[model samples]
Target chain A: MSGLQPCEILVVDDNPGDVRLIQESLKDGRVPNRIHAARDGEEALAFLRRQAPFESAPRPDLILLDLNMPKVGGLEVLRAIKASPEWKTIPTVILTTSMGNGDIKGCYEAQANAYLVKPTDLGTFSEMLSSIQSFWLTLATLPVG
Target chain B: MTQTPAPAISPITLHLLLGDLPGLATCLLGGGGQVLEWTEGAHALLGQGREEAVGRPIADLLRIPAESPLPLLGQRAETWSLLTRRDGSTFRAQLITLPVPEGHLLLMHPALGTPQPKEETVRELMELRQALDESAIVAITDAKGDITYANDRFCRISQYSREELLGKNHRIINSGYHPKAFFTNLWSSIARGHVWRGEIKNRAKDGSYYWVDTTIVPFLDASGRPWQYMSIRFEITERKRVEEALLEKQAELEERAAALARSNADLEQFAYVASHDLQEPLRMVSSFTELLAKRYKGRLDTDADEFIDFAMQGALRMQVMIQDLLAYARLSNTMEGTQRIHLEDALDAALANLSLAVKEAAPTIRRFPLPVVMGDLSHLTLLYQNLLANALKFRHPGRPLELTLGAEREGGHWRCSVKDNGIGFDPQYAERIFTIFQRLHSRAEYPGNGIGLAFCKKIVERHGGRIWVESTPNQGTTFLFTLPMDRSPS
Candidate 1:
């Protein structure tokens, strides 16, 4: 390990089981990373902006977003993130159960870094996370803000 | 009161008296009813002068018999007779015969109060009779509605001999399809000398039904009471049949359309509810089981690892199946989603969407110029993506994949085809392959829920086109579908 800082990943999902599954997958995978959680879109935005209770939250290197939530949806959060000059370059990956073309297109149009359909199988989900870890965190260069 | 008669005027003096009356034709007949003189009025009324009338037999000129009772009366007598004109046509005239010194002097004038001359009346009656015989089914009944005359046309249309119908009432052909009030209204109008016009359904002699457009006119007597009812009818059975058939077809079409709309609405709702509810639990099961496998793969036994893998694959496959079903159900809602789209643009979107697969297959795909079509752009994109992906997925083992995609105008639509040099199945399963979840090979060989072609078919059909396939085992497959041209040929 070339004395590099651990990668920070923020998982925003309304479903706690899905968030936990993702965290467990990341933990078991061979990746040096730290995982943060936001239960809904509102919390996701608050954490990203470091507002109120999240004032001391670290800026995430990557964001894994769920499309459906109680407040502002994944697309809206993506738009908000991309609209800000400071946060626009941060890679935001959409992880959604919706395989609809409109959802996929809308997420990309909002300037998401990538879109991934959440696999139903635990093994596939874990495999997808491992690939993401290797490709985005380990290999690919990212903007330092 | 008996009073003394005035002084008697001589017949010649009365002739002299009538000489000044305009349009009064006086012809003096000599012995044996022969013309003695033609007065000036006679020349004006008969178009014949004294030169033509004088010395001619008066009875012949007047179209009267010499044996008439008026000649035998031996005194002044007044009677009606037909007077011949120069044109050989006859007119009705009132003749007053006065016995004079040697013969009878007849004074002829226009018949009293008649609207038309006798010859014109005769011609009009004849024409009316001919018209009824050729075009109308006529029946004349006495004031009591008992049939007195049934013309040849009436007999033919009613399917009854004239002899059998001459004394029968109009009820003989009553079909009983109308209420009693219908006939009552008809009779009331005709009895009052007001013509009644309506349609009547009558039964023929062979028990078949016929329709007639009828007009019943009442002939009034001198006392202004109806003496006869003349009914003129025209057959309208064929026209009525066509109208009824058109109405029935319209009603059937409306009912079918309503049923289809209701079914479509129900399917949309079912798709929405099923997709939302079913995907939630499926996501959890699959995600967690996959996590279990990743976290404890080496720590668990081989059976445990295999069972976890099985559970994960089953849940994931079920999720795909549910998503496909949802897609099929959503097709019903896309009927109104149409626009003018370029086929090449849609294909481009599909190729871009399947970039990963296309890169992996490393296949040679040739695309030609495509025509513009009318349909939902997104749906068309999906259609092309699915078929292209299918071609890539089913590539023959140990052989390089090659694809040809192009479109050409066929009749009123563009017939587009995708030919692939991939593993082709038996032609017998061609129809089965398009059915939902019908797979030609094991899942291990090719991965699909067998809904792609069906989806393509639905999209094509929604745009008023059709889809078909041609293939041979171990060779290749070609999928052909059609999309209506932007505008039909003029």
Candidate 2:
């Protein structure tokens, strides 16, 4: 059942409610997948570097980041992720409330794969989540390990 | 020879007896010197019948003062005195006594108050006449309106000497501002016994114009018919000059206002042409790049593919900028027509249009009640689309996104704010970010051509408002802007 080792995704956020929502949205109404959440950017980076307890963690195939958090921010995470050749190949998509010109430009400039604004309405959120599954999980052809 | 009983006492007899008479007199004096006969007027003065008093003497009835002219009449041939009569009243009398055929003759004439006509009174009246001639603005014309005499003031005010004015007609000072018919009518009206009084503008001897308050009076002969006219005038040149200057300034201001209006219209037209002309070439460049990029993906090397992609993005950016510029130009030139735009509805439409990115980020947003603004639905739709997309796109990587939308009242209108926890920028570039084609981030940093914020700025400005941002790097951004409820106050 692990077709191509179900694409690994790293979700970074401090808010439990949003992390749960994103986890539920990404669980595959279309493609079956396992989801992991990091409460902050630092923990998310630790997971990506496979250090300590996360030494057995699989390399993430994609990252969904929140811009606001306690320890390190999403822009910093994007920068660190894109800087290291070990993790640079993994796609990073900015998933946050920010629609600022500087924020959008900053994340993409730090080499994020995509940028997305949060929809306030529920129906739209569900639709967007489903479409994300369709586009990234189905349409986008990533290099297979 | 009963001697006609001698006409009792005639004026000649009264004149002979009142020695106080100036020229002649006669008196009848008896032994006691009682005044006997007076002139016929002396009968009026003495009140004694001549027959009765003829035999009496003067001393029995009248008395003389200690220092008296009546006695002096004997020492000096004639005397003047205040004489006391029988009634005890005084009279200013000149007495002369001359013996007549009848008896000792005396003449008395009482003199009352009679002012002597002095020569200086006549001389002073003549001086007054000369003073009026000097002080008043005066001129005398003959029966035909020709100048017969002009005083010094008349010549000075008219800028003409007496030599030049004398014998010349009133037309010498004519300014010609009035119609010739005006003067002809004036003369004809006055010649028919009417006095003509009017203010006039007259040319001076040096060819400068002067105004005057003038009155011309006609003098009549003994036959009660007009024989001459006298005109008096005072100069009013300064007042006339002020009036002319005020008129000239008013005319100049009117001309300037008309010219300024024309230039403003020309500027509007130029804006229209410039933006419209740019759109055609922009479309060609963008479309050709996309064609090359699409058709040549595998054939191009890494650098070539990258170059082609950058070129296509640039062309596409140019196309969007041009479209926004054209829209901005039209917004200003066209008159504003508005429909109420529902905030939630427009916000929903914006999200619907932005579903692709929303899915990619999988963000969570919070919004409350919103305000409806007066705007064209199309522009408002685009405005919401751009703002929503921006909020979704600037999210943090590896984080769950949270966005908030809200509205508040500011400066007589509603301000919609989009607050996000995205990667924020420096606040110094807030004003510059709204300028056309002004971008804070490079194409490598952001996917947009930097036209979205500029478009939003234009929409807000056209609605008579302002837009700005507050941000710090790595922190969230709050985009605050206002839109007028209506173009004009409701």
User: Runs in model 1 with CA error above 4 Å?
Assistant: A1-145, B1-3, B7-132, B135-150, B155-209, B212-236, B331-336, B359-368, B395-404, B408-411, B488-490
Docking class of 2: incorrect
Query: Fnat per model, in the order given?
Result: 0.86, 0.00
lDDT of 1 by residue, B6-38 (tens): 537766777667755786877677877667767
Cα distance off (Å), candidate 2, residue B372: 3.8
In model 1, the clashing pairs are A120-B286, A121-B286, A122-B286, A122-B290, A123-B290
Candidate 2 lDDT, tens digit per residue, B1-490? 4664454565445545454554333466532456555554555465545664555655444444444525423322566555545455444566666543344456665543422224476468568757867666778897788898998888887789999998899789888899988888878867766788877898889998888777787876545567788777766678767887889988888888788767856765676677665654454455456556666887979998999888876776665666566666666555357767677787788888888988988877899788777876666667778877777878767568888888887778988888888888888887887776777777677777677887787777666678888877777788887876644444
TM-score of chain B of each: 0.64, 0.42
Candidates' DockQ values? 0.44, 0.01
Docking class of 1: acceptable
Please give me the DockQ of candidate 2 compared with the native complex: 0.01
Please name the candidate that would achieve the greatest DockQ relative to the true structure.
1
Give the best candidate by TM-score: 1
